[model samples]
Target chain A: MKAIALKLCSVTGMKWGIPFVKLFSGEEVLEQLKEIWGTVGIPLIAIVTFLLIWHFGAKQIDTSLGQVPGPAMVWEQTKALWAEHVDERIKADEFYARQDARNAAKLAKNPNANIRVVDYTGKPTYIDQIFTSLKTVFMGFLIASLIALPIGIICGLSKKIMQALNPMIQVFKPVSPLAWLPIVTMIVSAVYVTNDGWLEKSFIISAITVSLCSLWATLINTALGVSSVNEDYINVAKVLQLSPTKKTFKIVLPATLPLIFTGLRISLGVGWMVLIAAEMLAQNPGLGKFVWDEFQNGSSQSLARIMVAVFTVGIIGFILDRIMVELQKLVSFDKKTIA
Target chain B: MALLELHNVSKGFGEGKYRTEVLKNINLSMEEGEFLAIVGFTGSGKTTLIKMISGLLSPDEGEILFRGNPVTGTSHERGVVFQNYSLLPWFTVYENVALAVNERYPDWTKETKDIHTRKYIEMVNLTPALNKRPAELSGGMRQRVSVARALAMNPEMLLMDEPLSALDALTRGTLQQEIINIWTKDKRTALLITNDVDEGILMADRIIPLTTGPNATLGPEFRIDIERPRDKTELNDNEEYKKTRNDIIEYLMDMGAEVKTKKTTNYRLPELKPIMPGKTFRKRKEEDKLKYF
Candidate 1:
């Protein structure tokens, strides 16, 4: 039973369930009971208490858009958003079916004619905006990692390189995504000109802004990781006469991986945050844009809808962090320190 | 020709006024298949000497030659067993040994490599902990793994830098026996740098003392004429063992005192006017009394 619990904890993100399993198995009942309470019961109770406060406190607050949304109002808006997504998906399916049918008829009439089916260019729902935000953040994070890791390694390996790059890193590290947004928008607009391209100009601008803002964390962390490699390991490599490339991959990379992953996690988080702000300011299609659009809408339902987006963003951010934690656990050799 | 030779090797750290000479005019050599031990105090340049032989460090004054060739940089020809074990924390014992074996014998078959890796691991008696990472192992066990890794490389020479110092007495004794047994079976040209006088006598064909630094150098060599399979229990009764141990200890003690005297006497106040020694002493005493009054 313990074995099963351990396996379950590792294979899935159900480590919180281990205490319950132990309690059921009658192993140190009092301690396990406390663990269960701490892991599960306490969080549930706190969430319930928060909802109660929000439900009551929402009644006293009033804005130009009417009362602030209570728990029920936000839930209603969440349901409405989900329902709108489902309705849009159904309309998209019909549009595709109609296009396919028309394309078939055209091909039947004249085999040589162009029968291209147009995409369903409908209004994106809340779910679509969430997906767009995720895609943009990941793209930016990937780009940031690719550029930062090599430069970081080189900087770590050589003091001369680090000295040369130090000024640039210091100058650019603290710049806000908002500051980058204008320059990125201008560059992307000037460079990415096409009526129907693989990616939109707004997306390229937002992604570039996210990369500019987020790359510093990864760069700094990776350099630190590389610099902090063990002297003994370096000696081992020297004695073994390991080629430079092999030394980096075999000894240096493994030694510094924990710090590198730490940098990546922070970079991913920074990228996610920067992406949202960029989307909102650029009026791009994402959760941030959805919130901005609702804020400008100025209806009674707008506040509730925006509240729904707020919860969505918080939950998604938490999930993204958890994913990075899991990745870190997989890569890190020092397991005792991770938790 | 000697397996390794160092000719008037000197090394120092820092530059100009801040410079501190750690090793000075140190000349030493080891014969092929001969075990040599260097005993010294902490900060006595023993580690620096070992690094020089291993080609991890370059001498400022002279060159080190291995098999008549001038040693340039670190090479697979010399395998080192470091004091701290230096195992990758992520790798298991088998993997750690295998990493070196793979590097040293890259063209060997997989089966041959695995067998070779296992043979040395078995030599160190770490088969039970073969799957365990360094973090999981005790200090003694980690050292054993390092020993196994160095041996598995099949290098022409083995260099150990205080490898048993971190272990407790019991583990250290056991590892010493294991090292002797391994050396007896295959006589690799080996050099051990240790601070322990007893360990040096027990392990090496000859034990050399290193003077304390600000410019440290080898003092004298004491050849251990003890027979093979030297028993720890009977070592107390052996006259030669006692004599070697006492001679090394006495030399180290005298070296310590000599360094202290040298430090005080070597300070030359050349700018001050020379005076009669007794007169100056009286004058300083009178000056002290006047200041107090």
Candidate 2:
């Protein structure tokens, strides 16, 4: 690094000493020369800039109601928080044992008074929220795929079906999943035939609402993509007298893959986005609930911790998209990998 | 009985708002192992006629029979080689051939399928590039792959819709010879749609000059009785071959004259350009002149 700086200094001195001669000489020589700084310079500059902002810009947030802690403070708290977490784990065991002893003691007095009387945190654990959110998103995505793929294929195959469905699809597509949350919550509350508790049914309703809102883009685009396949190939399939099943699998599906993949990527992104918002509105036991609860509590590190969750979400979503893209490249037949 | 017969087959496009007859009372028949070339104007329904025989489409006004069976939809018995690139873009030369091979011979094991598909690939002299996709292949190589694909199907009848017309002369000549070689060995019922007179003479047993559409029909059937395994380069030197060549040229010339006389008096234009023979466009101008009859 010192050698590089010295070299640059010498070059600059040379450039200053004889402007015309040095300028032309160095310009002509180094113009075509590959420089290490030239290759890695931009990214290095960007990383430095990002670090500076992350270190300094976070301090400027004028949050009045809740104190948004600095990165260093958060790091310190995070470590202390982990120790507290261990302590909490032991406390939880103690609490459960205490409940058992209390129940045993109370059986002699009155059995009803021993009915699980204990202090409730009324706040979600980090691990439970993460697991809950993941399960809900996975279930909602699966449900959406099952319903959308067939309808998409049908609309793709037949023009009349597309024409008939287009109006309804268009109408429902733009309405936000958040908009559907309240209606779904109400409907389920009214007609959940299971004698189960009211609270249990809301999660199912929220998932269905998220699915209906986020899944349309994939289905509509997939159908449109399948329809956009070259007419000649369809005729070729016809010329082969290929069975309907064969035509769908061999001809239609392969032709529509690039488009279908585009839809899938977009749907997954939308589904994840909708899921967070839905959980917030419904007070569901998920990551969204954790963020909302922290916000309401007005903790100093609440915003910083939420920032961590947000960044983590963004990183995870990016990785998921990249995985889909990699899978697409692998399955695609048109591209040749000499291997 | 004719191996394939088209009886008073007439076809038209659109109706009521706009109706135009493309073929009128088209009558033709071909025996088994007899090579027939149907030549015509571009939109003269030559392809449509062959399609009916191959069962790509049905004639609305008449009956087309393949050995007395009514033609309907696509039948595997009649295999077709289309002019434009019809080889699946995604499949390799080997895979393209294997598609039909595996379908036709499903009882064969994977090893057997590989062997048989390879045999046809070698037959077309495309073995080195068998693993290459259609996009990777040259025009001639792709056409050879198409030929291999059609042959692999092992159909009773072969229909070619100007299969070699897209190629340059050198590539065209090579594929024509390969096709003739394949034809002589199998002697399947073959129908070729072409406007190249020399190509017709070289390959088909009978050349049926298709008068150009909007109402194109067979003008005449010229017999090509040159010996089996006809060498393309040598045929250009034979006496009988020359006679047949001149006869076709004369017919096409008269057809062009007829086309010239129908609308305008510009029948005697100065030698603006040297007329290229055996090209489909020059031949199509002949049928386009059938304005009156």
Candidate 3:
């Protein structure tokens, strides 16, 4: 205030020496912070600085190669996605009826009084699409784990089994999910038949493909984890003459749980990522198809709309991982010894 | 027949490209209900000796007999307490002990198993922490829980590998007294692997010093003539205790220093100093002559 007073009131005449009060307080700023924060003052400062940097960082990002859109565009895209979803709700029943012969004609034609002007594009609601994708991922993830955990445990416990499986595991593990898609599609298409034959058996195909691709990482990592359990613990188990089933349930499983959980988390992450890509390529009704269609449209805000899906994916992946970590901590009561 | 016997025992590790001998010509016999302490320099095959006795590791050249029956792999008849606390951390103290009880006495009901587990838990003075996991327990407390776990199975021969080395001095002494009390109460056969001379004097009827590896063998056995329930604090007044402790210490110090000097010599070192192909040889005979002489 005094420096401003000297500059504006005294015509820059004591500007240097006029801020004695301000300087005295300024010198104590760090001291005050130290008193308030004790040890965390520096980290607090760093966090504030980082937030400032992030808020002004939009212009620096190059959006040419599918980088995340800025916050303003992302928010607008969310509204646009909502509008698209609303448009899709108007004609969904009619489109399914035209493709397959299973629709109630009156409901398809009327769709109640909820009918609106933009009703031709004909899509499922965004909520429905999200639910559909979530259902597939959960199903795939469950089956993958159900198969992988036992097989992985068997490989871990027996040297003979491990030796036989090692080559097959190595060969199949590196094979991409994209590569396996055709084979999986053919299998499900051949194996799973419907009562009405309405939607053409796409549901099971996508889920199975997702599972086959995602589960290898879990199985391999878990087997390795089980194999690495301390030899002394095995000795402990043997000396006690624990039955094989009891040994597996009690000693082996608990000892190898952290590793199994780690594999599960990784497999889950892969499943989520691959589902989006699989849905896009496989023409499955999911967030991927929605995002993929928007991208191909190339509207003025197409990129922005796709940005919303991208953000959702990232946030969903992060939340999924967090869920698994919390689950792991809950199940594994083993206090891991610090090596 | 002795309760446990090592007949001309010898052991080694690896084969072909990296073969190395660990134990050489170990012959010993233990009657039932005897407590023995084997004191040796670090890496003197004391752990290997214990492992061979427990059948965790097999001796390459001899038969380890439990009352004239050749030892195979691990069996509940001989229980081992490892150097580090290997209590399954997921289980509470009671659960950890109960694992062994459940395994050992599968025919018993859950109530009987609970009673069996709690009996040993109380024996180790860990009844209060029966529901506490290893992470929440202190080092000595964890060790006590391990002892409880081992004792719960009621193995005929108890094997301890420096079970108190990680504890503080006071805690070690406290547990030392507790272990002695347990041993005397049951009079089960026990073999303790320790480098502590005072511990050897306090706990064991006989102490054996092992020479340094890779040709390490049992050197000498000292019979502690001191009375039972030996007090670590007041052992200085006994003249025999003084002589035995000093003799073992002096013997172990020499063996320990020999290992330190001999470890750096790296008998496998090759090529760094321009060695010829012919010089790369297994000089076992020469090394043996140099070491044993």
**Where does candidate 3 stray beyond 4 Å?**
A1-71, A83-122, A197-200, A296-298, A333-339, B254-293
Task: Flag clash pairs in model 3.
Answer: none
Model 1: residues with Cα > 4 Å off, grouped in runs: A1-17, A36-57, A91-121, B15-19, B106-115, B127-132, B254-293
Residue-level lDDT of model 2, residues B193-235, one tens digit each, is: 9867778888889988877676666787789999977888898
Which stretches of candidate 2 lie above 4 Å from their native place? A1-63, A66-135, A186-206, A336-339, B15-20, B40-45, B90-95, B105-119, B126-136, B253-293
Q: Give lDDT tens digits, candidate 2, residues A1-339.
A: 444544454333322223233334555445323343444455579878886777787667678654456567666655654566567777787888888887888886886773777774634456557767777776777778788888898999899999999999999999988789989888877888686564456578767877887689779977997788776677667666677887788778887777776677778778778888888878878877767877787777777667656755676676667666656655565644311
TM-score of chain B of each: 0.89, 0.86, 0.87
Error of 1 at B39 (Å): 1.6
TM-score of each: 0.86, 0.74, 0.79
Q: Which residue pairs come into collision in candidate 2?
A: B212-B287, B259-B289
What does DockQ give for each predicted structure? 0.63, 0.34, 0.49
lDDT of 3 by residue, B1-293 (tens): 68988878999899897987889999888889999988765677888888888877888998999978899988888888988878887788888888888778889998988888888999999888888988899999999988988898899999999998888889999999999999999899999998776787899999988887887888888999888768776787889898997787778667766775787785766668655654545456445433322
lDDT: which candidate is best? 1
Cα lDDT over the full model 1: 0.88
Q: What lDDT is obtained when candidate 3 is compared to the true structure?
A: 0.79
Candidate closer to the true structure by DockQ (higher is better), 1 or 2: 1
- TM (B chain), model 1: 0.89
lDDT of 3 by residue, A285-333 (tens): 8887878887778666677777677878887887788678666766776
| TM-score, chain B, predicted structure 2 | 0.86
